[model samples]
Target: MTETMDRNFIWDFIEDDLANNPGMKVHTRFPPEPNGYLHIGHCKALCVDFGTARKFGGVCNLRMDDTNPAKEDTEYVDAIMEDIHWLGFNWDDRFFYGSDYFEKDYELAVGLIKKGLAYVCELSAEQFRDPQYCGDLTHPAVSPWRDRPIAESLDLFERMKNGEFPEGKYTLRAKIDLASGNFCMRDPVIYRIKYVEHHRQGTKWCIFPMYDFAHPIQDALENITHSLCSLEYEIHRPLYNWVRDNVDLPGNPVGFPRQIEFARLNITYTVLSKRFLRGLVEGGVVDGWDDPRMPTLCGLRRRGYTASSILDFIGRTGVAKSDSLVDIRQLEACLRDELNATAPRRIAVQKPIKVIVDNYPADKTEYFEVSNNPQDSEAGTRKVAFTRELWIDEDDFAEVPPPKFFRMKPEGEVRLMGAYIVKCNEVIKNTDGSVKEIHCTADLETGNGMPADGRKIKGTIHWLSAAHCEDVTLHLYNNLTTLENPSAKPDDKDYTDFINPESKIVVEHAKVEPPLKDAKVGEQFQFVRTGYFCKDTKYPNTFNRIVTLKDSFK
Candidate 1:
């Protein structure tokens, strides 16, 4: 790996490891089990794993450790690859599966058995039930087949390979200490007789290696140098190494793959656990894994988040020791910052209020050149139609002003942005007590005044020509869960219980400027004062408001 003068801490650690062992090559791999869709947490992990490899000028392998076939499927594998590719990481033709090492893992287990290091355990499903099956440091639970003869183990294991065992009839256990302080060191089941089909290997095998036994060996077999993972696997490291030491390498796969742990990302307001997310999908609380309100990478992409924003978010969150939940606002800020510099400015009206430009001639219409970006001058400009009628945000005007409100009020003068200065001559109301529309007269010259002059208004607001506006499907998103009370346990309650019903608000036939009708999918643009938005990838032609320049709600 090539190191620049400003090396990140991860590089420093890798450099030290390599400095100590010059013979070893630096390689890293992101081994996500393809059991469920990846979430924001996985996005962060991907950044660390792949970004570190890129900086060091090394290769990062995308290995799907699909060891547990029961919960895994081809759907997951496909989604995983799509997410990784979307995040802009190519695994360098080193894509792999732990099942690729099934034969080796089985052979190694048999070797361990032959060497008296493992045995076939006959802990009946009843005996392996409940707390009795759980392992702990002080008191390790014993299995019935702990004392089984090596020959019996070999025979059962061979039969297991030959598909002679029923699913729960026998489990191959590594004969480690029964009372080690580390619960994993206690005699753990290395392989289980699972008669299930695998996504990649198909119906070729019945017995599968357990994750703990399969993962490290696959890394060693691939000659992987650094196996960076979330902190949860820190405890699993001991067993990770124990399997490496016991199983003699095939072709002497390089020094046992080193395991490093960093805190995993925990995004607040939405559940990140695969189990909980599964419940959300299966229970119909969410439309699916890719629901724009969900935090899956696909969901983020569909919700109009840029890959660079995600990567920047991950890098900024960085590695931590004690894990804490991050506010979703922080993520939105990254997008807002990214979009502000990239997206063009356009006017859209959600809950639109109609305004009649009483002074403009009915047949008159004109174009005012508006800059695409307010922050950058070189971003240039686009023309917008200023007709006799215009639409502004419904909330922009009030019949009786709320004191400090600057937008629009009875007799208030606010510039209809880029068009003309206008005064609210009247607030038209319905008998039902809702403001139907506002009547205004434009200052022809205070547009600087053939109609009026130097008219100072309290506020300048966005407007789209009523005659020239295009219909758009707009989606406004909010946090899925709504407990502003931060101390509320996101884990204790069913995630669905906390779900904000207003999370995904869809607006049909929302009016927008004529320019955005041809706006392509994933093209970001500022909707005037309405915050940052992009064409949703799922809808492509539809717009999704991401976040605003200011945290107005906060």
Candidate 2:
């Protein structure tokens, strides 16, 4: 972590904590439950957790909160680690797992039971949440087993852990103030029984501690100085504090892990909930978890979003206490800003229109020197082949030109980007009245310099030599959800109703400059006048558009 003057409220609080406490270390942890692939929302938390720690020269642990075996898997665990690393954060030697401390957490549960601070309850899932019994924790609504004998409660807890009792038969709840306004403090369940196999722990323990109970203990055991989480857990702060105060932490430090909540990332046009995204995958609405249309970190990467761009987006979004929806354009703008300076330039014709130069020798092919990236001088230049036969964008040519149309038209002159000026002389039509070919004559002296007459050409269009171009596929992406707030629909309306039918458009026979034939997967380039694109990792000869050349959001 590099020391810097830039500070957010989180860092300000940490600075005060460090100033007050002499010789204490600044430490934070990114504890993500390995239940599903990480989404864009997690990226914000990741940056804050790791970025803060990095700024202050503190250690950040990457802990897996895999307390619930029912939904967790090693696959998600692997994906979570990959996503974190992909975002340019490393956990180093501080990687830990919540399930790894099951024995210690079990001991703490026993300590709570012996102290009469926790007990085994028999309330079913529904009955426990019944407003008649637990109305916001504002009044005393005791469970039937609240006053059970310590010995009996402990016995039941042991039996529950020993697999003698099936799941839901018994649960350990904290014996806190039942009249507290905060429901989280109202004797929250600390542990529950589950007979499922754990991803890491295997069948070692059938009884697992609940998230609220396990998270703090795991933090304390690992000496985590701060626990960063989203705003939804703000109310649970009281409970988090209660666990740290009640349990005899391993380190017994003068101070314990402090919990801070920040607004989670929300973007327009799509839902970020794991369940909704999983539904999209399962319902065949999306290709898979890594579908370019999805907001998963892996999906964004596959769609050509660089880690720096994502980090910049997070930085621009800033850390806020209040929740808000960020316009997706901000993210796209960050990506464009990054790619504009980094991606090399290339020429790709999405809709190929054949052009034949009558004055140029058909058998002669010449090369024109073109800069690979005008923004980057060190990127140098490459030679693009020019010949009598060329391919340009269909939209760039119109037989009956529209008003002010500067591209190729009957008898209209335009400059071939980095090549000679050409004048369209004839337009060949097919039986369907669509253009079949355009015959043009190029001024031999106009190339690599001004024309002899110093004529100004308003239109300069990219082109690829017909004999030297490579056939490629272009994938143009649009918003995945038609509705701006797809997840906010009425309960009766399905989220799938907002799925954008034209989200993914494929151009199968696009033509690109010959140099693109060697483009490796993940290599990015700006398709001059089209968009920024990356060679597809999943599909051969395909380039996924990162963003259009200009901002549409404005």
Best by lDDT: 2
Off by over 4 Å in 2: 1-6, 136-139, 552-554
> What is the C-alpha local distance difference test score of candidate 2?
0.88
**Candidate 2 least-lDDT 10 residues:** 1-10
Candidate 1: regions farther than 4 A off: 1-9, 129-137, 250-255, 448-455, 483-492, 552-554
Residue pairs of candidate 1 with colliding backbone atoms: 1-56, 2-56, 444-450, 444-451, 445-448, 445-449, 445-450, 446-449, 449-452
> Looking at candidate 1, what is the lDDT of residue 192?
81
What is the per-residue lDDT of model 1 for residues 304-393, given as tens digits with 9 covering 90 to 100?
Answer: 888888887776676665677777777888888878888888888888888887888889889898898978889998888888888888
Clashes of each: 9, 1
- lDDT of each candidate versus the true structure: 0.80, 0.88
Please provide, for model 2 over 1-554, each residue's C-alpha lDDT reduced to its tens digit, 9 standing for 90 to 100: 22211457888888888888878777899888898899898988888888888887888999898898888998998999999888878999999888889999999999999999999999888888787777653467668888899999999999998899877888999999888878788889999888899988889899999899999888888888888889999999989999998987756465578998889888899688888898998889888888899999999999999988888888878888898888999899999988999999999999999999999998999999999899999999999999999999999998778899998988899999999999999998899988889999999998877899878989889899999989999999989988786547779887788888999999988999877878899899999999999998899999999888889764
